[model samples]
Target: MTATLIVIGHGMVGHRLVDALRELDRDRRWRVVVLGEEREPAYDRVRLSAYLGGRSRAELSLVAPEFAADPRIDVRSGTPAVHVDRRARTVRTADGDVLRYDALVLATGSRPFVPPVPGRELGNCFVQRTLEDADALRAAVRPGRPAVVVGGGLLGLEAAQGLQLLGMQPHLVEAAPHLMPAQLDVEAAHILQHGADRLGLHLHCGTTVTAVHAGPHGAARSVTLSDGTVLDTDLVVFAAGVRPRDDLPVAPALRLGDRGGYLTDVLCRTSDAHVWAVGECAAVLGRCHGLVAPGYRMAQSVARQLTGRPSEPLDAMDTSTELKLLGVHVATFGRTPGEDGSAIEMTFREGVSRYAKVFLRRDTGALLGGILAGETGSRADLAARVGRPPATDLERVLFPDPSF
Candidate 1:
């Protein structure tokens, strides 16, 4: 007899779960049903900013025709799983239909966090999340219009750059001392700061938007900063951060982490044995990993468990991040800022701006952490050496042959 497995949310991580299961479940012992809330199928959200650069919706899609054609996998778009009836082993949809399943996986991902500021409901205030949000932003923005992007983190910088590309005067507001406070150290952030300036983005650091005042007809007119400065802008895009989507199913039996997200064990199994959670929606071992890499690992673990395949236990995931912001290559692997005494630090620089920093274990000389800016061609090799001490000398490893 075949078992029914219902997976909620068909985003990248969610879709990967389906892919893993389909690859391993050769006997077709399980029937997979993926439910997505979006009208369109899963798309590459990481490249969401590319929408401003002339990328079409179809180009960013993660789903292929094969997923829809697979007989073992049923892909349901435009339908959201509203509630889960654990007692009856069924899930209720938005149209009031119930789906019976022997196992369920929650991969609802996360939603962009909009700060609670006055007049936030005003028109022309947008978020950088879905394609729909990008479309709305594109339609609302006009050349010469001043736009303020709240937040100076990864997504915030991306939003600012997108607005700039749209011919709007972009202003980046960040409460932190520098941009990408979580990822970059002081020196690297300064380099990125210069890049932002070169891109013509107005930088407002160490300040927060106290309130958003609107003009007539509910359109945003200007934003008041914490420092008592008011900047007139026609649009505002919030890219502060994202919180996990934990409101689904309404299952009282489901456990949530302190900071939100479905609580799960090392196996990605929730309080209920038959139920599991992955991606941004899951809080593994009481902590939620927002990056796609960790979520992908979680999906693999869960898929292996359901397929009765032996897999390694989910442990401390490598949270190293590597991405481009405004055409600048930025990467931080292993540890970003290791204590001075705990680790030996080495630094390298190129003409005025490019930089690379690596931390080695004080006693053992193992790679502990690093930060790279402007150029990061060796990210893959450096990332692989993380945790394990390399046989090569620290100098040789850091400054490897460019040919290799």
Candidate 2:
């Protein structure tokens, strides 16, 4: 007799869980049911900005035709699971359908965090999270107009670049003193800022949006910064951050993390063993990782466990990241120097175009973390060598000789 596995949400991580289960469940022991809130199938949200560059919706899709056509898998797009009945082992959808499940997985993911400011509900305001959001932004884009993007993190920078690509002048506003404060140090962020300036992106760091002023037709016309500077703009985008979507109606509510996600164990299992949580919605051991890699790992671990295999513990999840933002290369891996005051820090710069920094343990020379800006050719190599001492001289490792 086959058991039923119901998965709520169909974002990248949820899709990954189903894909992994299909590969591991050789015995055909589980019938899979995936409920996606969005009408469109799973798509590559990381490159969602590419939609503004004329990339078709089909191009961003992550759903494989084979997986979609699998006989054992039932995908219900646009169907949102609203309630969970743990006692009855069932899930109730928003459309009045109740699904019975031998096991359940919550991959509801997250929602973009919009700062609570006056006039935020005005038209022409957006959050860069879904394909629909991209479509809305694309429709609102007017060539040569000004756009304000709140936040200077990865998503905010991406939004600004997309606006720029659409021929709109983009002004980035960051609450932090520097861009990507969570990942890059001040020097590295400065290097990235220089690159953004070269690309014609106006940045206003160390300030927050105090209020959004409305124009005619109730659309966002301008934003006032905390520093008393006001900039007129046609649109406003809030890319500050994300909060876990863990507001499911459960009869016996599951434990929640202090930071607001479903608290799960190392195995991605919630307080109810039959119900598991993965991706941004799951705060494994009271901490939530906002990166896709960690979510993928969690999905993989849960898939293994469901397939009767031992699951890998997520105690030391890797948080390495590398990306090109507005034509600037940036990468960070492991614990940054600021994350640990005891760590030894070393930095190097090359002619204002490149900067690199590495943090090592004070007792041992083992790598703790590193940051690279302007040049990131060594990102993969350096990330792979984390937790171990450099094989060569630290200088050569961080700043490889150009002659070589």
Q: After TM-score superposition, what is the CA distance of residue 240 in candidate 2 from its true location, in Å?
A: 0.5
Sequence-dependent TM-score of model 1: 0.95
Where does candidate 1 clash, by residue pair? none
Top of the candidates by lDDT: 2
Q: Write the per-residue lDDT of candidate 1 for residues 1-404, one digit (tens) a residue.
A: 89999999999999999988988898889999999999878898888888876799999988778777889988889999999989888999998889999999999999999999998899999998898898889999889989999999989998888888889999899999999998887788877888888777899999999999989878999999999989999999999999999998565669999999999998888999889999999999888988899989998998899989887867677788888786677898887555658888888766435777888888888888798887544687888888888545654554455576
Instruction: Write model 2 residue lDDT over 296-375, tens digit each, in one string.
Output: 99999999999999987998888889899878889988877565469888888986678988888999889888889986
lDDT of 1: 0.87
Q: What is each predicted model's overall lDDT from 0 to 1?
A: 0.87, 0.91
Q: Model 1 — which ten-residue stretch has the worst lDDT?
A: 391-400
